[model samples]
Target: MEANELLRKVRKIDIKTRGLSQNIFAGEYHTAFKGRGMTFSEVREYQYGDDVRDIDWNVTARHNHPYVKVYEEERELTVMLLVDVSRSRLFGAVGEEKREMIAEIAATLAYSAITNNDKIGVIFFSDKIEKFIPPKKGKKHILLIIRELLDFTPENQGTDISVALRYFTDALKKRCTTFLISDFIDTHDFTRQLQIACNRHDVIAIQVYDKRDTSLPDVGLMRMTDLETGASRWINTSSKRTRQAYSKWWYERQQSMSDTFSKCRVDHASIATDEDFAHSLMALFKNRGVR
Candidate 1:
């Protein structure tokens, strides 16, 4: 991508996602992903409903009146975006490519973090860690992330969620909220690693996919290739049995992924490229806030 073109794309994302963060997500995000703990804000005179445990005895004795300690939620947090840059992201099929949707969604979350005064970081991975951006708070840093999301190309073309999670656990010592954004297409079972990571950090999984990933139109014989494995094969799509088999395989895959997520106790949402991702995201955030 050219320098000017990249800037333009970044600007476009900035405009769209910034508005969403400001108008729709900031409060929900803050409520959903809380800070580490509460911090002492100030002391105030005890009210009728004040908790006796929070009463400042020393201050009370000094003033000869009951006073209580007041604390505010710690507002700062470090957020990590665990993004998959595998080759399958290039497929748009019926709508926006998974890669493009990932960029937009990631950018929205980054901006939402900014609104909440949290530091944002990103880890791009395929078969291995492609790049890591340290957590930092600033519009410039966020714009840089958006630029990378829009333009960065990976050296490998595979998916390994476990490898990325392992690397994240070792790299970041503090327990922070991490978003795993991917298609969930890896053949390897990473349930063990996911469980470990979720135990350490607040992990949320967002699965982006294309409609064609689950079903195909009976448009006659067609040839297709696996994006990650580069294996090619011809399929008789016109045959009803072939279509049924493919659909059944897709359903099985979804069920397996759901089971892994359940075992890890991680919150997750799935959205197709053609669907409205904002609604799904907001629903997830609202669910978390209520929890």
Candidate 2:
């Protein structure tokens, strides 16, 4: 993309997602992801009904009266977006490509984080870690991340969720809220690594999908090619039996993924290119409250 085009895309995303973060998601985001812990603000004279444990004996002795320490939630947080840039992310059958949707969703979350005065970062990964942007707080940093998400190309074409998880765990020693965004089409045993990562950091799986990935239409015979492997094959889409078998396989795959997420105790949500992702995200936020 040209320099002008990149700037235009970044500006467009800023306009759309910034308003969303301020108007729709600011409070939800703050409530869903809490601060690290409470920090001592100051000490004041003890009042009725104050917690006895919060009383400061040293200050009470100095003042010859009961004093209580005040504390507030340490609101600063780091949000990491682990995005998959494999070839499969390039597939989409509707309004926007999967990659485009991923970028938009990432931008929305980044904006929300910055609005809450939290640090935001990103890790673009395929089979390997393509790029890592360190966490920082500011609109300029957020825009840089948005620009890279829109333009960065991966060096590899395969997906390896395990590698990304391991890298994230190693690099970020402190706990952070990480969003793993991907189509998750690769066959890899990431359960162990994902479980470990979740133990150390708060992780959420955002699975992006297309309608065609789950079902096929009876549009007669069609040629299909695997995006990750560049393999081509012909399928008789007109045959009812073929469509049924394909649909069954797709459903089973989805079920297996869901089971894995359940076993790992990770929160998972699915968004399709043709659906309203904002509504789905809001539902997910509300559901998290129940937990």
Best by lDDT, which number? 1
Q: What's the CA error at residue 150 for candidate 1, in Å?
A: 0.7
Candidate 1 Cα lDDT to native: 0.93
Q: Give RMSD (Å) of candidate 2 vs. truth.
A: 1.1
Q: What TM-score would each prediction reach against the true structure?
A: 0.98, 0.97
lDDT of 2 by residue, 130-190 (tens): 9999999998898899999999988899999999999999999999999999999978889
**lDDT of candidate 1 at residue 119, scale 0 to 100:** 94
lDDT of 1 by residue, 149-238 (tens): 999999999999999999999999899899999999998778888988988999999999999999868999899999998999999899
- Where model 1 places Cα greater than 4 Å from the true spot, the runs are none
Scored by lDDT, model 2 comes in at 0.92
- Per-prediction tally of clashes: 0, 0
Model 2, poorest ten-residue lDDT window?
A: 282-291
